[model samples]
Target: MDSGQGCVGLSGRRNRCRVTDSASVAVSGRPREAWIDVAKGVAITLVVLYHAVMYLDGVGLAGAMAPLNPLLDTFRMPLFFFMSGILAATAIRLPYWQLFRKRMSLLLYLYAVWVAAQTLFLLALPPISPDGPNASWTNLVTLFIRPSSNLWFIYALPIFLTVAWLTRRWNPLIPVAVTGVLAVLFGSQILHTDTPWDKMGRYLVFFLAAIWLGPRVRRMVPHIRWWHMAVVCGVYLGIVLIMVKLSLTRVPFVLLFVSILAVLVGVSVAVVVARAPGFDFLRVLGTQTLPIYLVHTFPMTALAAVLMATGVSLPTVAATALPVLLCSFAIMFALAAYRRLAAVPGIFTVPVASWVDTSAVAQRAEQAEASA
Candidate 1:
């Protein structure tokens, strides 16, 4: 099915296009690409850094890092959800029922499992508050209903996915128009309510923008010059710095727009990095993002807790943030390794029997045999 300029075609027999192929062809299956993974890598690392800072603040060092936190907030999770929307485009090509079941179910499983893990981890630790809430049964239940922290992304994604699916047939401008209205409402504080709409209002725009404009974004990549990206990055950094200096931290709509710009900058950087001479590490990090996302929070929080418990001095907090970030990466690496080891054999690796076009594999095999 072609929706104006955008074509929706069956991604694969798996009911969704592989992430690598989502942007390559007119819905026809194609080999996967690496730039998106690089983008995802950048987004996930920013998330870890954001959490690290949050952990530092929880340990009473927020005052020291307050200058930098606002700038970080501009891009952190906006890049994340934007990338998610890009990734979601792959499944959006699938039949409605299949798309809903696959994407929603996968997210639901991951969210449920991690939420349970988080609960258990807190129970084992001393009583503490990460974001101004006391540890109690009511708070715990509240988390499931409306997540109060980083976990809210998981809670909100399913809803966004559903909205995108239902509104798939509507004019793309509809979402954009709705997003503009919501931005106005949110910026003016017209509702005088604390509903999740406040939070949802901020991100739904980016999410829909990503889904609706993903193809156009992908097509522009090849034409973007190095200087164009450099200029965008410079402007974005300047805006962020000015916002921090002016102490304009309360404007959600402004931040939301900045976040969209950040996505553009991030995606541009990813494209350049993917085509550059080196930086395999970013690609590796990106591929392992799922495990990183799941495990980074705990160690980051635990590190801050330990520091606070020992009554660490303030000056040391700046130095401590880097270590906390490293520890989070280490924890994620360990979990990823464990997951790889525990996966069923065929599930962990590409199946040798499933390749209908085996010329590339056969050629590689012959080369290996000759080398041997």
Candidate 2:
């Protein structure tokens, strides 16, 4: 959900590595990687676009964006998580409790706060669209149990990071093997699980793959020449077309392979735009993805409500146009909220007092760490 790095350097940690303000960076004094931010920019745009399509559908404006839903679905979230894993790969090696205290605490806090915020927004405005985030207040009770909200990604973050941390001590290949199996099971429809859980299972391998391969990918993204992008793009397009023609994307094992390739193709795209001049806006959007992720839906929901009330039917081309429009509006609105409220202690960040004791908690944490 965020482009900011996770956790921090700890003296007694598993790997004395530092996660930084940049998504992935040269804390040893290298410039912040623009490619990472660019990739996230691409991902977050797709994310907002997807949401806009869903929210607008009930109002009879499923627009040109509707057709892209399946193609983009393959790698959107997976790319997002892979980028996250790249940034947090170092932090994932922190001793379990330290990792929990720093990364999990913040993720959990943000998750809880945003869940409540979404509930309040829906309660006051009451979305008119049936396909909106959540319809019933009863769904609130299952926030943790079933994760019946748009913010399920936030909920899944802490859980996924924990899994990564828990397996940090094991042979790296082991967790990937296990998660790969789970992804195949859920992805191929062999496992009939509920929505969020099913998605969580399906994406677990991508994150771990990032953790395992992040450094190499980061190293490789810079040297990626235009011809490389052309080659991969051709291959990706061919494979996708073949899949669509034969419906091999739905085949059992092929689904996972195609999804993996989709993520790579996504990475390949950043190579073209990353270092190119005039793409700084995309980089900015990437850095600010956390705010956008948390708050973008507010504006989309309002769009849904407005469309429903006005009896205005958007043009079919709006599917292509509406999502970009919504993405622009939503990103601005969220960024404004983030900046204006950032100074207020408890708004943009988790209020330390809410979860941590300033007095004795550190001592207790030390003791707990030592004993455990």
Candidate 3:
């Protein structure tokens, strides 16, 4: 089936679509695109860096990297969700039952396992930041009602996939418009609540937009010009300056503008790096991002504990730099060890049947051979 064609409707009223075509599949078992991996690599790295800096600053082990954290925040999570949304569009063409059993089930499983692991980990240790949100045994209930913590990204995925499937046949703009309104309402504080639903609302627009414009974006990224990059940078700097000067940085719309620009800038940089040859290590991180994300918290907390125990002192820059290096290396090493258990379900990886369409994959391989 074409990307734009799918069965969409409310619960119990949905139809299923046939999968006849696939995007970015190759005859070889290797991936057909590198930019996706590159984008993920850069985003996940930013996540590690942000966590490292924040933890260090919080514990008085390092000076605050406040300005730096805000700059990274503008795009770090957005890139992740945007990439996820692009990938989710592929499965929206699947039969409803298949989508649920494979895509949704897998994400839900990962979220459940990791949330439990994270909660237990927290209980075992002194809290990283005295002011950090407490994860009690009671917080486990939030698993069903909302996300418990950083595992929220995986939890949110099932929700986005379900929504994508239900609205598969509607004008893509319908959900986009609705979600956009909700984002504005929640983000503007007009609709007040403390729930992950508000976050889901804000991110849903990017998710749906990815489904709607993914192919077009894939086509456009390769052709992004020097001048285009220059213009984006110029505009972003100009707006950032205005916000800083006016002290309007906390204004919701100002944040929204920065977020949009940040996505563009981040994507542009990732595309450029993806086209280069030196960042293969980052590509590996991207390939194994699931494991790395789940396990990184341990290393982050450990580093903080070590600093507190040793009472070691360092220059402000060294405090920030050292934690990033040590934590990143530790997480990478831990993930390498965890790779052995990846075959086991609810371990490091989720247990689920393969979600890719076998027949469509075969067709793509045949076409690849023909073109070869």
Top model by lDDT, which number?
Answer: 2
CA lDDT of 167 in candidate 3? 94
Model 3 per-residue lDDT tens digits across residues 1-372:
011211111111011111111223433565536677677778878877777777776677655464557655557776777776766666676677766653455456667887888788777776566586436887677687867656677677777887888999999889888877766676566675577666766677777877887778778987977667678778777776676668765466665567668777767777777777998776656655666666677777766766665666888777657656855785676576565665454464333334322244433333342222
Give the lowest summed-lDDT range of ten residues in model 2: 8-17
Model 2, span 1-372: residue lDDT tens: 641133221221222222213323343445456777788888988888788887776677877667666766776888888887776676665566755665566556666777777777777775556555445575567678877458777678778888888888888899999998888888778886666888888888988888889878877876888888888778877887777778775467676787788788878888688878888788778777776888899988877787777888756776568777877898899888877765565455555543422224433332332221
Better of 1 and 3 by lDDT: 3
Regions more than 4 Å wrong, model 2: 2-29, 130-134, 353-372
Task: Please name the candidate that would achieve the greatest TM-score relative to the true structure.
Answer: 2
Candidate 1: tens digits of C-alpha lDDT, residues 1-372: 011001111233343211121232322333334676677777777777676666666666655454465576667666766766765655454556555444454444455656666766766665344454323455456665656455567667777777777778789799868876785566446643575556666667777778877778778878877787798899899888877778664564666567768887888888888787586667656655655666677776666667766776656656655645554575566456536542332221222223211233322322222121
Each model's TM-score, in the order given?
0.76, 0.86, 0.82
In model 2, what is the error at residue 116, expressed in angstroms? 1.6
lDDT of 2: 0.70
lDDT of each: 0.58, 0.70, 0.62
Q: How close to the true structure is residue 178 of candidate 2, measured as C-alpha lDDT? A: 92
Q: Sort every candidate by lDDT, greatest first.
A: 2, 3, 1
lDDT of 1: 0.58
lDDT of 1 at 80: 66
